[model samples]
Target: MSDTRATTQTVRYRERLWVPWWWTLPAAVLAALIALEVNQAVSALPNWVSFVVLFGVAGAVLSWFSKVELRVVARPGGGTELWIGGAHLPTSAIARTAEVPRTAKTAALGRQLDPAAYVVHRAWVGPMVLVVLDDPDDPTPYWLISTRHPDRVLAALQD
Candidate 1:
């Protein structure tokens, strides 16, 4: 018998994308209007109260959707890693792998909005796989991961 031991069990890639305030202008405008109405009900509140409340809500919304990080790793022994956020999933916990296309508006606007310009443009561009993990406690059963440069992350996971 041979002796083999594993060191790291998981490897994840996490990144936060930056969203410009202007991208959220429409939502901000609506939030500001609603805040004004609420502020009027609280007449004792200062004039800056509405602005603070409006911005607070806007900031919260922006913060929630500002960034996306993708984590890809190898499973222990012969398993896959977990990927959350967007679709909430795991590599080995899935059966089917598909290419998800970006909506026209999202694509057009995203070109300008994507600071990293890592948008998935072509159908063949995605070698993304869906994993099906065996962990019952695990939440997601499937994860979408890029096939391009899979080794870069795969090697990282092995290390």
Candidate 2:
């Protein structure tokens, strides 16, 4: 089953947070290094081939991370919905919403979180919104979503 909801309406709030330069830089460098190593293994390959491979790998990695978007849309009829990448959750199903502190965020991502909880986390982002699921049918206990504006996300979830 797909995680996204099919909807055709204007979004109430949209937050797109790209992977920080720090994260991208390392990924690019690593990709380039790997490409170089591959080129050395295959001496017949031209230098330009390695460069193209490096940029292609790096660009694909960067593009995937950079395209991550968090959206909170108010459905036309009545409910609020949260979207992280391709996953979507209706606010009605959220039992609770809170703005998690940095320490709590770390703990949640580390030892504290339940194995059943869903996490949409980005290492570069600090503040996050924690949404506890109320739907009994769903096995997920909660969702940990990284966001630059945690308060805004919390408000949207509550609305």
Candidate 3:
């Protein structure tokens, strides 16, 4: 006997918010400077000990800056979900959506911003998408998600 099952699932948009390549050089330079200071201050420890600090600092910067990821996934069961970091929301729950340009970002994140809104903002990512939610049970009125390609993200959700 043979059994066959077929399923269709697709990832519409995916963006990993990693620290830019240029940032690595600056982080390494800063780490080296700190290690030099540590070496000067501590004469009893071996010179190699300062190298440990240098590596640690560089690793920490890279780790922290590369964490958040944005994705839109289409389910085989039928529906779209938006994922940002650890949180996920169905696109059906979104009432309206808008792309906030770099110039308007400050205003979007400023005084008018709601405290209960879900925000996955990154300073390094210039543009973001504002998702206004219609779910009554969820107190979150909106979600501000940082993305490198705001238009693509919006298109995925719409489809």
lDDT of 1: 0.49
In the range 1-159, model 3's lDDT, one tens digit per residue, is 012211355789889998788888888888888888888999998888887878886989798888888888888789998988778899889999999999999998999899999998888899999999999999999999888899999999999
Please give the TM-score that candidate 2 achieves against the real structure.
0.82
lDDT top scorer: 3
Give TM-scores for every candidate, taking all chains together and pairing residue i with residue i. Answer: 0.45, 0.82, 0.89
User: Which residue pairs does candidate 2 place in steric collision?
Assistant: none
Q: Choose 1 or 2, whichever is better by lDDT.
A: 2
Stretches of candidate 2 exceeding 4 Å from the true structure: 1-7
lDDT of 1 by residue, 1-159 (tens): 012322454455443343555757877788788878878888888867787878888888777664444555455676655443344344444444443333333444345333422232223233333233455665544333443444444444334
User: What is the TM-score (0 to 1) of candidate 3?
Assistant: 0.89
User: How many residue pairs of model 1 clash at the backbone?
Assistant: 13
Better of 1 and 2 by TM-score: 2
Tens-place lDDT per residue, model 2, 1-159, is 122534555577788878776766787788788888988899998877887878787878777877889988877678878989889999889888888877788777888889998898887788888899999999999999899998888877776
> Cα lDDT of all candidates, in order?
0.49, 0.82, 0.88
Each model's number of backbone clashes?
13, 0, 0
RMSD to the true structure for each prediction, in A, is 10.6, 3.0, 4.7
Better of 1 and 3 by TM-score: 3
